[model samples]
Target chain A: MSKVKKNVWWLVFSLLFLLVLTVAISDQYYLLVSFLFLIGTMVPLYSRFEKKKIQSREIVFLAVLGAIAAASRVLFFAIPSVQPMTFVVIVSGMVLGSEGGFMIGATGALVSNMFLGQGPWTPWQMFSWSMIGLIAGLLKDSALLKNMRSRLLFGFVMGFLFGWVINLWSVIAYIHPLSWLAFIQAYIASFYFDLAHALSNVFFLWLFSSSWIKVMRRFQKKYGLLD
Target chain B: MHTVLNDVHPITSFCYYIGVMILSMMFLHPVFLIGELFLFILYNICQHNGAKMKQMFKGAWFFIGVIVIVNPLLNHQGTHHLFYIGRNPITLEAIIYGGLLALSFCCLMFIFLSYNLVITSHKFLYLFSRISPQLALLTMITMRFVPLFIRRLTTIKAIQKTRGIQMDSGNIKTRARNGMHLVQILLVCSLEEALQTADSMEARGYGVKKRSSYLRYHMEKRDIFSLILGAIILGICIYGKLKGFGDLQIYPSLGSFGLKGIEDVMLLILTLLFTGYPLILEGREWLWWRWQK
Candidate 1:
């Protein structure tokens, strides 16, 4: 087979291996193992295949960003304000591109939850934050999202969207006595946190918009990425 | 932290989760809820992780507020009048009932928090590595890609804005249209990434042979003991629930029975212990570390 086909088969096989690994562990272990493998193996694979050049400095920066994202979640519990982590994840995406952004978001949840404790929600948290990173990466190269207002808006929408999507998971995984109504109630109850998160995103965007642009420009120039 | 307790066996933890879930759904015991809350608080204090406890409370405040506001308005059935608000009559029973509901929620949260402490993603994957590779792979990829997708969307939005497209200060319809445009971009990018991943995995021969894990979780005697203890607690709780120990009664006369005296308290404590085991273990570990130091 050609090199491309061989690569495709390898990718398919690895994914299958991941599935087997997930089943081997019990539920609690399943989430922990899956997350580690994703960060440890799948991420590097993507980086290698894409031939992405990540400097040591970039890795450190992403790790620190992950730490801050995790810290912000802990802070969210105390302040009862907007979600600073969502904005942080978005910013990480803006600066680091898709894979870096993803690692930051996923790792942030993984590490932070260690402190706060875990549950079924950990996977959901990982999924939600990762989605935020993915969205940011996709928009990194768009023509229309380069302005300050648009970035701020994107951040705001993400805040709300993040809440909505996670609530969808809660509706499915959490067995509420009220059934369907429980989902609605959970969504409604979560509105304030979502609003706080959305507002925080707006603030962060306003506070750091220019610096972000400069950083993105420097990253693109330095690495010739997402061109 | 004797690693034995700090690190609960995955099977034991999973069983505990199922037990708590079953209790929440069927039993609806006020004692169980209250006991769970007390244990969670005690465990939090013991861990000295004030920061995490604070975060859990803070993150949950909005939801608590919403429940406080909506429960009375929607529930509407109760006796023993408390007061009158507008045209609505607030009852003593509804308030007490709402409090119970909130407690129940906190119990669930505590269970989840404990689970998080004991279980890591790596262990989760290890347990399931041999069962079904396809599902495991899909799950792993999904977890891996979600954040990547979100990150890409953010950058794409920024790039679009730089090209002179304004997304803010628009009508709802306009904002939504812009949002859809971003989503479309993400969908396309993700598809490409998925294909690339597929190619990479195929080349590596990922599923061509049996896979071996880098990290191994050995099930020792403690693991068996923990599992047995978890089973006993779960069995008791199930037996109690089946015997109608804590069933809620709501009808012509609003009252509940089945949870009374020592058995009630014991059941409550057990439920809380099961839910908060991780936190308790973490707390014990911290204490032991402090002593050793």
Candidate 2:
């Protein structure tokens, strides 16, 4: 475990080294921040996986759920941004707790992108989905998440938020100086896609969120997993 | 697997992507960018044939045209004014700038597509597993689970069809409900089976001792040859870049972009050899095939 721990720390430290290397080679701000933000999120998540002491049971559960999440993304391909990937992550958090939720979200994004084609957007997708899982996990104990109305509301809001975060990739890559006008224009244009995504998230949460939670909870109880 | 990239070590492939991406992004000079882009297309064609390369280029020309048409609309700058679009002046600098951007972006896209081809998922996980076996194993299993799950979904759908469950054709709500029901079945069946997987792993002594991956990828002679060749070409390009041979300045003004002399031409030639190394390797194989024939 300690040895495994060291590798994650190396992942964290290597970012600094990589930052120095990127700076020495290129004077571009976009390159610098992308590297920074990517590594910054990656290191913590790797450590979180380590700290959880997640066993084979939890891992298999996570992997299968992640598979379903990715498959669901494909299943809903015709519907345009309406998929249960985010919904699955959110419910995984509510049931399996925070880290488990985060794992499902991150892994779901990673596996889907592996099939879909990995690109600059891959890391950002992982980051966005992981955050949604993490946030949901943190709120699992609260009344807000426990209540169905608030959960649906949260899902709707998160739908829009996820799209906004994803929109950052285009801004980071193309639009230099990050002008407010240009940024707003891009955001405004993507509003419909974001709306569709958010609405779909709400739909999933409203419809199947409770049932998924029940199934996972029952499975975890039966196997004594994710404790 | 037949591609030249399939033969190179993952480390080498990783370096190639990073190098090409950084270069494609950093080198704004049309000479360097054009040469890079040309070799990228040539290499892509050689590796994936015209079909895959053309698939990549689908709508690419349209994108370049968009950049050429749209950049000047948004940005009104530079002394070399070309024409006007409504209220804005479309300057020569803006057009040139947009063209450079379009070219470099195409090169970048090629680099990414090549990466997708070269560093397949198992290789990527293999690289990561060297660092953290636990997380990498989880990710590898998750990646495996996707295709496996998809296959299972189709099987279940087929089984459901026998039972009068029509998922393939229905109203939107009905179709969506069937999808959810199919997913629910997947959840229950997979989770139930996951217990067996965990038991098997535990039986195999997983998580008890430090795990080590057994895949053996060594630096063969060709790997070493390509590595050194790659390093030398990369060194020269970076040195040239450092020496300001590949600079393409834009903004308040566009700077002179001329080849200084023989060194510049030789440098460009070196870059061609460097960028086109994949094509060289693939062509060598092609020649060997011809000789065999």
Per-residue lDDT, model 1, residue B117, is 52
DockQ of each: 0.06, 0.58
- In the order shown, the chain A TM-scores of the predictions are 0.67, 0.85
Q: For candidate 1, what is the interface RMSD?
A: 12.1
Q: Candidate 1's residue-wise lDDT over A3-122, tens digit each?
A: 856885776688677778766754423324444544554454434523544332333345445655665566455556454677768876776676667766777776666556665566
Once superposed on the true structure, which residue ranges of model 2 sit more than 4 Å away at CA? A1-28, B59-70, B84-87, B161-165, B239-244, B260-267, B284-293
Q: What is the DockQ of candidate 1?
A: 0.06
Q: How close is candidate 2 to the true structure, as a TM-score?
A: 0.87
Q: What residue runs in model 1 are displaced by over 4 Å at the alpha carbon?
A: A1-84, A91-103, A115-127, A140-143, A163-196, A206-227, B1-4, B7-26, B35-69, B78-84, B91-93, B109-217, B228-246, B251-253, B259-293
lDDT of 1 by residue, B1-293 (tens): 12334455666666656676656644555666666667666654554545766788897876566555555655556676677788787765666566666666676776565555545655555565555443344334444544555567679889988765545758744653465455445544544444455546657785576567665556777668767887888889889876866655543346754556677677777777776666655666779999999
